[model samples]
Target: MANVENRGNGSYRLTVILGYDEKGTPIRERKTVKAKNMKEAKKLLTLFEAEILTGEYFKAEDKMTLNNFFPQWLEKHAKDTLSPDTLQNYISILQKRILPKYGHFKLEDIKTIHVVNFINDLKKNGQRLDGKDGKLSASSVLNCYKAFNNVLSCAYRWKLIKENPAIGAKPPNGKAKKSEVYSKEELSQLMQLLDDKPLFWKTLILLAISTGAREGEIAGLEWKHVDFEKGTIRIEQAITEIKGKGVQIKGTKTGKERTVSVPEKLLEMLKKMELTSRQDKWKVRDLWEWPDHFFIFGNEFGKPIRPDSIGQWWRRFTKKNDFKHIRFHDLRHTSATLLINEGVHAKVISERLGHADISTTMNIYGHVLEEADKTAASHFELFFKKMN
Candidate 1:
């Protein structure tokens, strides 16, 4: 079916999709005809369709709507090349933001003005589309814009577009939202609250707060990775949900692995937890075999529990207890913050957090680092006074 859309400037798009090429590739032979009204645009569309159907339309390689080319781009460019999460986000932005506005316009027809207007609209309409009443945060608007930019960048590289409209368009000016974390008092209360919770939940909270590992990294932990004598747990892989693929074990996001030391008491707790897991495994021997990797925190049948369930449970627990609700990820932030306040070195903190670079640690916890700096300055002042 053909689509006709107004492209502002006494012009309209007549999207006459030429049938697939011999290689099963769609040939979108779109045309922009000068028109003043819907009736004129419809007539132009009919004529373009006839010419396209009769094989009379001159085939220009670049004259195609982004909508027509997007499928090809995803298949040939993004499907295997992009990370599953990133590809999924691109798809989301297309459905929620990009496609409805610019799908009808040819790649060549998308100008700087179009890009500017799209960005402006995003800024103006920034609000959450969920059942909540708030608008989208600036950071969210920037993320959506980035997804939009990514598509146009690929189009430019492929020579489908003469210019990349997003190259010079104003970048999203949304302020970065501060990471939510638990205060020292709040952190203490949280641990106390979890003491009576299930072992699965309690251990998870402890590991996150103590190790500063990502939720997926913690979810991916295996029994074999813990060395009782060494008191260290190796983080080699992660179990994350890919868009099309269900929960799967994949390399870490940074593609690097590190080992974190466990406190002696916590190591003892882990040993006790292992005994409990073994007892559960005994009850379901047929479900799992020895030598098959065993997840540390698993469901009834010794299978990996849903990773999102950790966050969901955290939300529910806080709500039920009438506590200030921070996400499960916030536990990791709390760990870093507490470690920083305790005068831990940034390099050690970075290693514990599994960050590939120390700069990331410095950047995320800049405020904490700044406060640490102030304390150091105060100590220097006391030393100078004593010397005098």
Candidate 2:
């Protein structure tokens, strides 16, 4: 039941009885509306009651803000489900960007307009937090959008919100930067430079180029993962560093293991490296702290090498040699590009790279594939010309 009481000067208070509480007291919802007369007030009251019956009425008393709900969502929802790195990323985005803007807003009060405005604001004036001038990058804004959308999605799923406002909001279509890779000539030059370098640097750089494995994946490799007879390396794990948690070994990026064939030359190098490790083990038997673990790229103490150390070394190496500056991960891109140029099938390349699907391979290396396709067309054209 519902009623409207005239509260003077065209103002009316509409109240609806929304059933009983556990103590049998009637639960009521009240809204104040302004109308010209009693008849208009009655119509407003009817509409309010209809909204309640249809579940379209938003409860004003819920009072749960984003600030209040985020912790609950993190504890009951995101913590167990998301990866540690991913969870940390979400927390960072929320703390630094999303929460600061709309955290005080009641969860139910966040509408599509709020989300739209938030995204627009991010595009306009979202300054970098690193004391750098200029607005946030398109990708950074996109990340903020994703994190905000995910949180609201959870809220909607948990019935805290009637709908996810983010569903209706569109984020900026940020273009992914093209992957940089070294040319064949440049790779040859790099390989030559590696010859004068230490065995560890030589092996690590060659392994990255030959296998197209990530830095962490290479760091996570163990002697047991190598098969000398088969000339294959099992890529089962990766090292990820969590803030305040030090280094942690986790499964592959896609949570699936793969076996990759390596060059015979690389395998022979691995054999020599294995012999050196065995000798070192014998020399420092009592001093070996990680006696149980046998990382292929372990430090002098036999602990797995930090993945960051690989990048740091590459930077110094590139700077010293005055080589064409490119990121260390570009070696993986270089490997893929070299294979594509050799006319290897995309599926084989996809599998070797441990991508979840061939489409991902195509997406990342599409430009190389395009160039390969052009070269293939030219070859066919020349053959037809010779036939003529």
Candidate 3:
């Protein structure tokens, strides 16, 4: 039996007289309530009763700590549902940062103030969990907080803890700044560099820069996805590198598949590449030797090209050509920026990029639109000058 009463600290105290402890002595566990009033105390009592009914009321074991439950929750529940890449990230955070600090503590012992202390400790440790190199990214620190919060939420759900300590804890602030797009002169230089490269590589880079399709979407494509008659290409799948699991070909990033339009000149280029593929039988011999089906940018062995490989190629191309400070993903950024610069509407760009939301399109190219506005004003000024 359990009852809760006001303890005069503007908080309530919950007393539960259960049974004998490990040594057969009569046991009565007293827990101080953090709730501010009687109504919340009643709610806590009801929750405690539900725990009793379910036979899950743990008597504050020393071994059951944040470190114990965090890993277990991830391994038992989250592993299968989360993509392999996400699971790996969780594992890295747990092993590198979380376990080192809180591994020995008990779950019930960790309070809201303890959470604040832990975050402060992270900052004191030079913001580097590994104790080497520089501070963690703002995104990475927030992810750490979120991971801790999730485990606490699980604990509360299982009645292992009274409340989540991480609840209302401050996460890292500020947005990750977007990367800059290539200028007209830079784009011209890149195009000239592409002209010097092999036909297949050049076409792949050109299509990526032009359409802003993800490297995986571009690589996972097939000849059938291209509609020369309609001048469009369908995006249906993505290639991912799953840690401890190598690679996987999966559904589109946004789950739903969609089509994107291609320029007529690009269509002509793809047709030419197809003709070249047919002419050079040996070019596809290795891919054809395998049982793997159609792939747009398959390897020499005919398997679907990994997105990492595309990244590596981009890196090598950039490094060799002295085009540093740009990512392959920046090609997508370049595409959106170029279109916005040409006065295309945000909705049209959103559809072209297969983004699920118009807001996503606007977020990516908002800077470009500001420049577009400036360009429009400049044009208007020039027209007025001509009239004068």
Worst 10 residues of 3 by lDDT: 284-293
State which candidate, 2 or 3, has the greater lDDT: 2
* lDDT, candidate 1, 220-294, per-residue tens: 899989999999999988877876667777777787899999888778788888998889888888877433668
Residues 1-388 of candidate 3 have per-residue lDDT tens digits of 7789898866887777668888988676666667878888988977876766566667654339766787678867677666555666777776777777776778877787867776666655377746587766767777777667766777777778767889867876536767777987899988888887877888898889878898878877877788888998888877777776666777776766888888787788899887765554466565473345566676555566778889898998888888855889888988888888889989988887888899987776777799899999999999999998
> TM-score per candidate, in order?
0.79, 0.86, 0.76
For TM-score, candidate 1 versus 2, the one ahead is 2
State the C-alpha lDDT per candidate.
Answer: 0.83, 0.89, 0.76
Steric clash pairs (candidate 1): 126-136, 127-135, 127-136, 128-135, 128-136
List the lowest-lDDT window of 10 residues for candidate 2: 54-63
Candidate 2 vs candidate 3: the TM-score winner is 2
Q: Which is the winner by lDDT between candidate 1 and candidate 3?
A: 1
